[model samples]
Target: MNYFNYKRRLSSETRIGDIPLGGTNPIRIQSMTNTNTNDTEASAEQVIRIVEAGADYVRLTAQGVREAENLRNIKEVVRSKGYKTPLIADIHFNPRAAEAAARIVEKVRINPGNFVDRVKTFENFEYTDEEYALEIEKIRAKLIPLLNICKEHKTAIRIGVNHGSLSDRIMSRYGDTPEGMVESCMEFLRICVEEGFSDIVISMKTSNTVVMSQAVRLLVQCMDKEGLSFPLHLGVTEAGDGEDGRIKSAVGIGSLLADGLGDTIRVSLSEDPEYEIPVARKLVAYIKERENHPEIVAEAYAGYSPFDTSRRETYAVENIGGENQPTVISDRSNGNFELNSHFLPDYIYVGKELPLAAPRAIPSIIDVEGWKNGKNTYPLFTSVNYKEIKGNAATIKFLRLSYAELTEEVLSLLKEDTTIVVILTTSHVNGVGEQRAFIHTLMNNNCKTPVVFNRGYKENETEDLQIKAAADFGTLFLDGFGNGIMLQNEGSIALKSIDAYMFGILQASRVRTSKTEYISCPSCGRTLFDLQTTVALVKEATSHLKHLKIGVMGCIVNGPGEMADADYGYVGAEKGKISLYKKKNLIEKNIPSGEAVQRLVQLIKDNGDWVEPDNN
Candidate 1:
């Protein structure tokens, strides 16, 4: 069997300008300069930096032909100086800018999100079906000439779709469902196809990594079904700077790429775009090694999912070979407890039906060895009183040591510089009050780089850390496993059961939902229809959005005010109608709930702009 046959296969030789995207090409890495396009020297310098750091292609915003004028000089100077990396122009709201850019750059990224139509008020939100068709035609009119110029110049186009700037009708109709996202992709693809263009790339992005992943999965699924295998560019948009962005990007992009998806990938850190290349290279290498080798995959699968069944667990590990092997480093907790890089956590799904009211606080930290393959663990950085022992041993209780005993005297004495996994277990250690006190002390201590503990969900919060953990893999976790240790100290596996009690506590708990947390009132006299049923239905319908936070409130007086943080909302209003909101600003007056979800999903799907609120 072909090694890359299990699922989606990214094109190995696809092109985006001179930058080959997939099919057989090296996975391309790209980033965009934050420098204003008009600043030619600064932008060119930054592009040079991006190239030196391994970026295959770099992009600059070309909002208009005025911007393109500066780019011509910038692109020329960069190429003349000996760098041949491709230049891509990101154009929005203006097709003229695209045409100008086609004259100088090798690629152009057209954000369907911000591009406008002939009559623009409707660009702000969803339209009636007739209105939608009319607007689509208007956009085509604006875009086709740009497409023709790109074709003539042999430049590539990227129909980059995102959440914040979609057409109004898309949001009104689809309300952010996977269906909505795919519809938006198809809508643009169909138009591009009609225009006789194929040198294209596609992407759907959101700030939420989970949602981005879901949108990608849906897009790829549809593309495969339709046999339309255009190259894909993967990204997690608006992802924060530094470590948080890296983790989120890894989860979303890495997860999809791991499953044999993604072509050219970008890890959108708020840092210098030049910093994106190394991460991109790492993701591709991991995927390539996985694709070319089999035993490595099997070995990784064995470690992450040692279960006897053939079913693929949340993560499947294969010891596939070459330099492309998955990163799995091993060290033991205090020298005796063995730890794998992929530490698997046992989980179960305990839905909203928690027979009785449960504990409010759950474990949020995990302390254990490293996580490799299917093997997973959370590290906790809290203190423990287990007896000190030599070699691998679980000291059930170790106490009677004052802070004075834990000084330099104790630090230098017990086998210095050893790895550790403090397994917090109920059977081996039990004391909530003591555990709480230890948690405070641990947090107050030196930074706990990798803290793992018993993590569970609050019936009230719906989507907390545990839910977040499960959501990272797109699965609902119900039960927690004893492998529930957090990496409180450094080293993936640290010796010494310093705080195994926390692990015991966490593994004993349960999990809830992941990402796109929803919080709504139970509803009262202000309620028009059944608020109970509405909340349930909306949750059921939009549960898969994964990256958006939605709120369903009752009553006009408080609904919008309460959900100031919601991405999309439905508030009860007078006459069995409801108000729609995006953030704190209300975008629409009142629409029937019967069609609200569908409408909102579509709006979000198009990566469209919000319709101006109807003050009346």
Candidate 2:
């Protein structure tokens, strides 16, 4: 795939029931049921709801052969009710269940991490070359049966790899990195090809958006080198509920989709499965608009690496770059600047006039004409006026320039000025690519001035703005391209909403964190308690802890391993019990579900990681 061009990665078409995916097919949206698979009535009903909500496919967890067999009953019920949407059986650590489901459902998803290899113990062990070859043979021996089953039944297969659930064998070789994740899937894909089974889909998921995006991109690169092209299934596993989940999903999944990678997508949320479809649909619709986007003419930067998260090196101009966290610049150019919320922006761009009562601590950006030599105020000059103000510029100045404006002369001038921070903007339809091109130019020219992305949105809904901005800005941040972000909306959305989302984009990108990050999984049949309700209780109790990451998983299937980056974990242990974890290590086992939240809180306190919520 061309990094600066808009072209979907073409893959062989794979038929899943009546809906075909990849190749020339439209991107498909899917969701999974949280109801117990054995409770066929509830599971079937949820699947119908998801289908009605615009899901092209629905999946249910098949932990054992019993649940796998029950999938046939669920499919029968849905078929009887007139919903012909393709059904996918989600299998983890159970080849028998995958074999059973492959014969019953339209598709079967098996995690390559544990389908054959043992569950991850995170224990490091050495693997000799011959030993590793033996392990691959083991995988081939186990996976061939499932591939034959799939081919015989005409059922598609998804070799899903999760970052948190990488096998001990893979970790021993690749150390739980993107390379390991890609190799995990490739090992299975190669086996499928050897078996002449071509009906397959692929996914690389993680709660960490950075790792998730990187792994998927790396997977594509590896696949291209070997000439394999299976349809991609995109998602950010364990993305928590509400706006955060939406933003995080968009950041991870949208980044890949923007690169023309995903063939099918699911917006995983800690809510009813049906609710995820609309968000997934909205995300797909947002990216689809770029399919025919105007051409972006640029060469890939020689210094840029697409597969890693290395911030583009730049000197700090004030606190906007270098070692500082990525700053947020609120566009209050309409003059409604009021620092009313806890989520404060590091800078405010007020266009021409600084708000009379604007706080002095938060720097303000003004048009070059209105910029006075005052404390905490900076001038924003366009390419045309930058030279004129260069001599009399403030100690810290903002230069607004598009990719086309970064001429040789401007590059030379920027290299000489240590005080200027470039505010990068783009009018092109492929704004992310254009802005990225601008950064690459600066990097190649050896300019150390910090560049802040300035994107303007008009007449868009709040959710649309969130998804779009996160995709655009989050993509750059993930690629290590920006030092700050300026989100400008001329729509009717509140400034506070925009402020919150700006921080959200930063947090989702893993560049900055201004609030508590939750890595809660979308509940499935294996979930032990009321996941939705439990997440709410956990959030309400722990939301004040801004510097922490908490994982609320419904069951052990998505337990410690899935929430690998989380500082604390609340995993379901039994029907009415919960397991609390300090990182990946078990803290307390099987606490009653009713007391899990308080117990988790007490666990945080016990570890001295808790702080009293400020009532002020």
Candidate 3:
């Protein structure tokens, strides 16, 4: 299979500076500078560092004309220092800044949510269809000058649509949904087409991975209906730091990339911009590898819309579904029964022929050739033998079903045995979809058998294997499907690592919370302190606080806004100063940087949100 042709939907090629996108070009990696744009030296230095760290493009925030005017100087300084990385001006609610920056930078990004909505007010009034048409004309008139400037300068444009920032008009009409995000970008995209400007890259971003992925899919679908194939830039906006961030980004961006979507990707981490490049490289490389693999192209079920989620209704199977959290099963077979404290799985499954005995305390699933009583475990029977073992009287019975080989008669057994929990396994090209199709079949027949999704992999590298497994399982979980997960790795990767990954995927999917959640922003020039060090310190102090969400932001831009969903917030106000927030309310202001973390701990204590770390 040709790598470019396999499963990929190609878009028209567009040029930004020296590099091109879409067509056969590699998926580009990009990062934005957080420094104050008016500080040319600092901005230029940050851009250089980002480029050196392997980013193909660099973006700078242009909030006003002063910062926009300084772009020329920054570009000159960067070029003089021998960096040719493309520069992008990130414009929000400043069309004049966009116009000025377009003349100097290779690209200009405008948020359609705020580009022409000058009043910045939220309203809830019904508008007639004719009035809506007039509103579009009025907004387009305001955007014409920026479009003209871009067309004249050959500067590419990215119509970036954010889920949280959709305009009041869009919200009132579409109700802050994926459809709203798509419509927000489409409104501007149509205007660009009318102005004869085709050098455009479009993006749909959200902190919610499901919404982000769905919005991008819908954008592509709507664009396809109109015969428009603009290149797509993919990112999960405000994806927090560390393991959680990586898994969430992989699930969102990687899922789309798997389907041959995305012309470029940016893994938005709450770390340094330089740190984002490697993760992006790894993800893009994986997609390229999959492109060459024969199993990459799988048919999607037309009945199942990629733009929406429908979790299969399932009854509880002993704390596995319904009101309980999704369970994790470990493959503790292969004669290895030494359970490690770090990798505690909910259940363990052992093969029938294995000689190792089940541990007394740990719950186990034992595969039996014939009906035999096992200690501290339940018998796992095959679909063909389910009827034979129906009278086994075990509290929980597991029936393993092959996705490719499942039959209606086997499914009919569920009606006879309500205690039988089905574990769906697949050896098909599209394992995820195959498993999903099984659930669809069950739902169509109104069979409410609780299904546990299982996948087997044989990769040696831990990170690569984690990425693969996370993508396979995380996508389904995002759609509110699956009652549990079972992973079987053939390699010698640490069992503890797999354990961490399974829980990490679950936590990232927002299905469960096992540790403190950090919504840290990727630091830029605008950051007031050493963001990496501060984040590490905070994590060290709060890692034991289960279910707590703490936001560690570098600046005010994404701090108050992105962390609005967090339980508590730590935002930088200025050099050597920090602000503390409880939910969205400011509880404390301008504390010295050295004392901020302690104050945050005390604040948590005051709110009765603190707990002594298990070993702090």
Candidate 4:
């Protein structure tokens, strides 16, 4: 709870090139170009497009000396065109490449894990002190030159830490966690400070939104306690495509930004990096606007679902447990309504349910028939005005049923007293002459009793009335948006689907291993082995083994380092064989790729002494 009240602010006086980053400046939005670095022309074209699209800063991954070689040309291309926007060189696995980029780009991103390993770059430095001092000296020998070059060129440097590429030493000590991530970054930041450079920016990105959020929270808190501060670039790394990614990014980034936390953001997507620009801009804009509103309260609760995930009705209703919903009216300019101790459902008041028009099948926003202007067809969401409703007890109806049997079954489930029901149709006859005769007839014939006890709409949404009604009628707002309701008696909403699988895999991070937990990372275009299938098979075959941690990583390059603390980890180091590790130390093994999963799983089970249950 020490961190609950901790309020560490980033240096408002910091700068990222010509764009001021901290010190009461506007929070920035950033994105990376995926164009092959080898293509200077193509990369330059994308940079110009990205600049025109409102990206504050653009990053280009410099894979090696050849890629770093394009830095000067790419800069010339942008600069010759009079584009002065800052360019960041994302240097991973090689500090020498970073050193080369330091002379050209406005910013350089270096992964500390890979940077420290190239001690040969700093072989000229000698120290008679212990290994720690020697390591620090060597680290400085390599980084100081790059820092000096950046300083001489008036460039800025940001240390970007992806949890997927964390250090082996840190992972071995703290486990792969938010705290471990913070520790790793701090070690790098300390070096940055020790070298007498405070003009620094830092980032911590994870595929898990929750961990990303929590990591920022811990970083700000821990640094505040230690009286160290830096501008933190926030992002949910590898967040997938379209609606789910957008929602998850919003919930994770929005929640923290709401608390006055981030300086810049990137929403990593699976496809076209260009798509990331608009989303990042909108995310920053939305959070900034929300900060000025007085009615929004500090989030004092948890299990916050930003979108509907429940596939069944019983699960959702059971979670509400008949809580009174605060009525949030869209009209707040005049403060016309004073909420006393009295509360109701978000929309309905007294005994009435609020009316919500359902979303109907319409033209797909992205027009899935094909891509736009000869682009591939992807799903996009059209805007809706429902966000104007500011109450928890809003009554939403899912209409335009496709099948009569499903509709009847859904109706049977909705009739329960789990929440107050309203059968009233769209009849204006209440205050005016109502004429919903056709819809009324259908409702009456479908049920022995009225589906909704009462229904009405006031100008638009009656926030006070709806909130009071939902509270009075045993209804509550759900964390997610959905067409159908869930009736569940448990807490955490279980996720399903490929998207949910990744989200759930990330969610497993919070489940503190009372024992062993299985961990795995997704393979990217660079993966040499069949990491995805191997991970699935390992998880499937060894899922019954409890109270132990097992990790299936794609390559030893970044995998062994990230999963250093796993009781056992299977890492593909070569095409035909893998290297096994028992909590940071590599165990003796040369299992062929064919039998890796079975051998790995069996070793884990035997190590943990897991016994299969007998079935009679």
Candidate 5:
């Protein structure tokens, strides 16, 4: 069987400084400097460090004309140090700054949400089609000068779109959706085309993984229709630090990369910028690894549309799907461990047939041949033998079907048992896509049986297991193909680690939110205080606030825009002060850093978002 081949998306190659993006170039890695742009020495030093850490391109926030003008000194300093890595001026709401940076840096990125319009002014007005055209004309008129400057300086431009920051004009028409995100970019893209500027890249970013993924796909589809093949820059904006952040970034960015969609990628973690490069590299390396796998030829029909959210219709099997949150399945199916509530799985597949007592009340799935007359467990039947087993009084049963063994008989057998939940597996190359195709077949045939996505890996190395399993399972979860996830390795990884990864993937995909989310940015020279230490302190103080999102920013430049999704924000306001926000509303400013955490707790408590840590 031939495997699914990832043919890179065709895009116009654009050069940034000495670096090239799109076309046949290897997918590039990018990171932004958190430093103040006016601090030329600090900014240049951070850029060199980012380059040393393997960033192909570095971006600096240019909020005003001074920072934009300072790019000259920053560029000179880095060049004097012999670092030719492309420096991009990140501009928002200021066309003049973009103009200045265009002449100074290799590339300039402007947000379409605010380049010409006053953002977050909360203006609401219904624009007629003519009014909309006039708005575009205004934006085009404002953009032409910067476009000309970029063209003259041979600078590339990235028209990045954020889901949270869509202009009121776009919101009135498109309602803050993936369609709106694409249109936001299209508005600018059309101007670039009209101005005869082809050196362009684009991004559709959001903290929400699903929206980010959907928006990017829609952008590609829409751009394709307009005959535009600009390169894509992919990232999950303001993804928080730690494993949760990593998993979320991987799922969103990796899913698209697997489909061969991204040209340059940045893993936006609330950690040091250098820390992001390694994660991005790991994801990019998976593309090469996929190419080396054995090819499996199969009809591609993932039951769900990758471009749109169409969750498969599944009948409720107790607590698995139909209304319940997606369940997590862990296996002691191959090893011996004491099952306790701390590491409890919703369901378990028994590894050995020994009737050993467990530490808690948990359901188990017993193999057909190993089944007893009155065992208090569900039976697991393979595709070939599932039809032979007599239906039991048990309300639920397990029917395991491998894609390699699926056939007309299996499909027919699957349809006959509404009580049987299908456990879908694939031992083929491109397993994720294969499993997706299997689900697609089931849905096409109108089979509504809930699916449990199951995969086993031979690698016991924890990091490798986590990344590979995440790439395989994350894409499926994002596409809405599974009701539950069951993962196994050669028994090398800890049960608790696997458990964490399972929930982490589910949480990161936004299918479930199980913990407090932090949106921290990588510290840069622009940061007024110690970001790494500050984030650590914030997490330590607020980690127990489950499902609450907190943004810890080093400075205000990109902080406000990046942390748009955070429920509350703790941002550095000045050299020794912090600002607090209640969902983008500034509530306190210039609070001494010494008292910020304690004061934040009080604020959370006042807003009824605080909960005492569990002590039981």
Candidate 6:
């Protein structure tokens, strides 16, 4: 991958119905239906809605041979309605269903983590070389049947692996790590290749943006090493609803898209499936705009590793770098402002004057001419004027610099100043790459000045701003760069909205946490209960637990394994029943649906993790 250049990764094309993916084709957008597969009309209607909402493909869950057979009826209905969009069947744990679905739909998605392996026991078991080889042979034996079916029907298969569901065989060998996720997918791909089957698409999905992005990068690297160039599918599974969902999905999927990695993408949200299409479209369009951009000339920095998630090493500058959580700097330079106590920014940049009535505790950044040495105030200097404070005794200062301003003199000045926090910005069309080059230059020159990423968007729509900003800043943060973020927008977007988005991007990148993080999966046919309503109920009850990570999964298929990192889980065990979990450990089972929310609250309180919501 080129850290400073914008170029798409070339991959072998795979056909799914009429639309082909990868190679020189455009990046495709897709979504799945939540309607019951057995209800042909409802499923077909939902599929049409998704397709009409700008999706190139639509998928429906097939949990058994029965649902798999129903896909034929759904397909017939959709085709009769004059829609030629490709249909995909999402299968988990059942080989018979995958085989049956392969004969019906354009594509069949099988989870390699559970397709043939036994359900995860979370046990510590060891496997010798012979045992591991036997396991692979077992997987091959089961997978060959589906491979033959796909080949016979000319159906593309996606070896989708989720972070939460690695089989015990893999966990015992590789643990629940990104490398393990790669091996899980690779194991199946190798068998497909051995069987002379090439209609393949691959995905690595997880709720954690960092893990999802890293695993996909590693998957590409592993595939390249083995002489494979299969088209990749990207998504962050269980990425909640509303702004949180949109921002999180963009952060993960957009980062990969910016690297020119993904061939097709899905924005998984807890909202209606059709609503997910626009967000996915917006994200894809935003990244595609960088194609054929002006060349960014720079070599990859040896000090930075794209595969690693460690923060770049730099000395502390008060609370801006080193061990500090990345700060948030609000761009209030336009003078329209409101201070939000719950979402207050660490600092506000007021072009030339400090607000007369604003609190002084949260520092303000004034322009160089407006520097009056007020309490907790810092001056903003361009690279040219930064030298005026060469020997000053100020505790901290903000120096705004762009990629072109990083010269030898600036590098020397940065190295000499321990109090300078560089505010990095870029005007190039390939902003992420340009800003990344700035960071790489600093690292290569051995400069330790803490740097904050600043980006401005002219988008008028909230979703567009969210998608664009998240992609820009999220790319840097996910790569373990940036000491803080400064988001500026010239549109009619409210200040509070921008403030919230800044924090949302930070939290989505896993660099900071300012609100509750919900890992809620999008509903599918296998879901035992109403996911959307249940999610809202759960959030209403526990949204105040700012520090807790909660998982609200639809069914057991995505329950324990997908939310592996969550602190608590509310999963559907069966019809009208809910199960509670504490970090993958089941605590309560078969609670009535009506009583589940209160019980979840009680469980949190019992575990000493609950907090009362502030009514103020």
Residue pairs with backbone atoms closer than 3 Å in model 2 (clashes):
none
lDDT of 3 by residue, 483-521 (tens): 888888989887667777888888777777776778777
- Candidate 4 lDDT: 0.52
Candidate 1 lDDT, 352-371, residue by residue in tens = 12212221121111232221
**lDDT at 139, model 3:** 79
Q: Write the per-residue lDDT of candidate 4 for residues 202-254, one digit (tens) a residue.
A: 78776555566667777777778877778878776544444334544555565
**Top candidate by lDDT:** 6
Question: Which run of 10 residues does model 3 get worst, by summed lDDT?
Answer: 292-301
Task: Looking at model 4, report the run of 10 residues with the lowest lDDT sum.
Answer: 358-367
lDDT of 4 at 144: 86
Candidate 3: lDDT of 543?
78
- TM per candidate: 0.54, 0.98, 0.87, 0.54, 0.92, 0.99
- Give the whole-model CA lDDT for all candidates, comma-separated: 0.52, 0.89, 0.80, 0.52, 0.81, 0.91
lDDT (Cα, tens digit) per residue for candidate 5, span 495-576: 7788778877887777777678787766665577887788888888998887698988877655665576788999889998
Q: Could you report the Cα RMSD, in angstroms, for every candidate shown?
A: 17.7, 1.4, 3.9, 16.6, 2.8, 1.0
Write down the RMSD of candidate 6 (Cα, Å).
1.0
Clashing pairs in 6: 164-561
Clashes of each: 132, 0, 6, 48, 16, 1
Candidate 4, superposed: residue stretches over 4 Å from native? 1-10, 118-133, 295-616
Error of 4 at 574 (Å): 11
Q: Indicate whether candidate 3 or candidate 5 has the larger lDDT.
A: 5
* Model 2 bad stretches (over 4 Å): none
